[model samples]
Target: MDPKTLLQNFINGLSLGSLYALIAIGYTMVYGILRLINFAHGDIFMMAVYFALFFVTLAQLPWYLAAILAVACAALLGFTVDRIAYKPIRNAPRISALITAIGVSFFLESLAVVVFSGIPRSFRTIFPQSLNEMIIIGGEMEVKYGREVIVGGIRFPVISLITLIVAAIALVFLWWFIFKTKVGMAMRAVSLDIQTTSLMGVNVDRVIGMTFALGSALAGIGGILWAIRYPQVWPYMGFIPGMKAFVAAVFGGIGSVPGAVLGGLILGITEVMMVGIMPGAAGYRDAFAFFILIIVLSIKPSGLLGRPEIVKV
Candidate 1:
């Protein structure tokens, strides 16, 4: 492949990987604290897309405002889900909680179908149109793949740059939130030992709720960006991406934020490279995550960044 084609694919992988990373972070956070998969997370992401769709299309709000509102609503919904669905079963058996999570996931998907209908909806985003525009500068930028982008001899899409920047910013903020703030400390404490943290006067329930909210908010961000990139919305839209993000979380080391990001980028690049290198295998794109999952589990169940569990009988 030519350098321009390689660069384009590279950017595509980064963009997709960034989304996976964002969504995977949510999965890791919830599992880290509660040890629950929270299968409904993807559906929550689906809801965020609808939320943004309505905020922009029906409510006639600007895209940026819609995004903020969508994230806020997602956070609220996540908090509510934790309070109503998961909270009651907190002390129950782990299997019970897992079943509840699956049920919640189904409920969200069903609710979306009923409310939004099964048909896909399309919408526009506020992303700069100039992103797709070609600009010529010194050295006569190289363009390939018909609509390929080039600036200062570097071949990459504008959307790719935006996605990378957004991912970086989100990770940095999350790092600060997890390591610096008191709430962050409480979250870590709860994750380490909930009973002890509760005894120490930390509101365990509150911390859990905040974790759900934070994760859901990040999911919301991922959802909004996804809609902007793909410009389509449907009830089942989150299923595949959700699974991919889960794979990323596991691949990177569940419960580790940085790991989620790493896994996401790796998964994204691998998938993109696979398709780019073997276009005939594009039909198998969805299978890539499961394949990676199986390999990762077989080699290191703890994942690349995750610490192995120690059990005492």
Candidate 2:
């Protein structure tokens, strides 16, 4: 392949990977705290995209403002979901919680369909027209202007830059919150042993709610980013990304923040490379992710970053 095409593909992969990482963080966070899958996460992501679109088109809001509103709405939805569906079953059997997650997932999907109708909606393009501008790189190659030149003329997308900046800020803030603050300690305590933490006077419920809110907020940001990159929206849009993000969470070690990011990048790069190397398999691009999920499960059931559970005799 030509250098230009190869460079462009790499930039695309990174942008795609960043979205996966954002969504995967949500999965990892929830799993870390509650050990529940929260199958509704993807649907929540879809809702955020729709919410942004609705605000922009119906409410006549600016795109940036709409995006913020969507993120806030998604956070509220996630919080409400926890309170209404999962809170009552907080002390139930593990199977009960799992079933509730599935039920909540289906309910949210149904609600989306009913409210938005089954038809897919295309979102307004958010990329600038100048996004396609190009600059001469090597004597034989040209690099797109949207791609940043950090050191040589090697090109990368502006979106990739934004993704990296936001992700880094989020990680820094998350690390601080989890390791430096009193509330962070309480959260860690609750995750280690909820009953013990409760006995120690920690508000387990509030911490869990905060965890969900944090995860959902990440998903909301990811949803908006996905819309910007793909320029399409639908009620079912979150299903694939959500599932893939879950796979990424498992691949990286479900409870590990850094693991989730690593897994997402791996998945994103693998899928992109698959397309690049096997042009004939372009139609199955989506299946590549699931195939990786299966292989990871078969080879390392505990996941790349997941800690194996200890059972008492």
Candidate 3:
């Protein structure tokens, strides 16, 4: 492939991977602390897009303001989900929590369909026209120049480049929060030993709730970016991406934040490359993610960065 095409493909992969990583971080965070899958995470993502769409179109709010509100609301929704769905199952068997997660996921999806209708909302109405314009080179390949960075003849979309930069910043902040801050220390303590941490004066419940909030906020940001890139939002939009993010989490290492990022980037790049190289298999793009997941699981069940579970006698 030519350098330009290859570069474009790489950028495409990076953008997709960044979104996956953002959502996957949420999965890994909650699972790390609570040992729950929180299947509704994807639905939370879906809701975020709808929330932004509503505020932007119906409320006539600026995109930046709507995005902030959407993210805040998503965080609150996540906190509530934990309290209503997962909290009650804290002492129950893990299976019960897993089942409840699935139920919650369905409830969110249904609620979205009922409220937002089944129509896919167009993002162009809200997104600035300048950002929507494309730069087509010789009618061969079309790409958005909304956010372009041309460095020594390698061009990248501003959106994809910003997505990568933003994902990296978020990851750094999350790492600092996990390792440096008081709440982060509490979170780590709880993840290591909830019972003991509670005994040590940490409010285990609060820490877990914060984990949900943080994770959901990332999902919300991811949802906004996804809507921008795809230029549409639908009730069922989160399903495939959410599943792929989960695969990324598992691929990178379920309980490790960095692992989630790594997995997402890898998954995103591979998917783009696969479709690029084999246009005939474009329909099977989603399958490639799952195939990677299966291969990763078969080769290293603990994930690329995850530590194996230790059982006590």
Model 2 / residue 83 / CA error / Å: 0.3
TM-scores of all predicted structures: 0.93, 0.88, 0.92
Query: Candidate 3: where is the Cα deviation over 4 Å?
Result: 125-127, 133-155, 310-313
CA lDDT, every model vs. true structure: 0.87, 0.81, 0.87
Give stretches of model 2 more than 4 Å off.
1-7, 126-155, 310-313
lDDT of 3 by residue, 1-313 (tens): 7878888998889889999999999999888887888899999999998889889888989877998899999999999999998888899988899999999999999998899888987874345656655544444554544546555567677688768877888888888998999999998899889999999999999999999999999999998888888888888899999999999999999988889999999999999988888889999999889998899988998798997881111
Residue-level lDDT of model 2, residues 38-135, one tens digit each, is 99999999999889889988998876788888989989898899999999999888799999989988888898889999898888744445655554
- Tens-place lDDT per residue, model 1, 47-140, is 9989988887789887678889999999999999999999999999989999999999999999999999999988567554454556444574
- Candidates 2 and 3 compared: the better one by lDDT is 3
Model 1, residue 10: C-alpha shift (Å): 1.6
Per-model C-alpha RMSD: 2.8, 3.3, 3.4
Tell me the TM-score of model 2. Answer: 0.88
- What local lDDT does model 1 show for residue 295? 97
Q: Give the Å error, residue 143, model 1.
A: 15
Checking candidate 3 for backbone clashes, the offending pairs are: 147-158
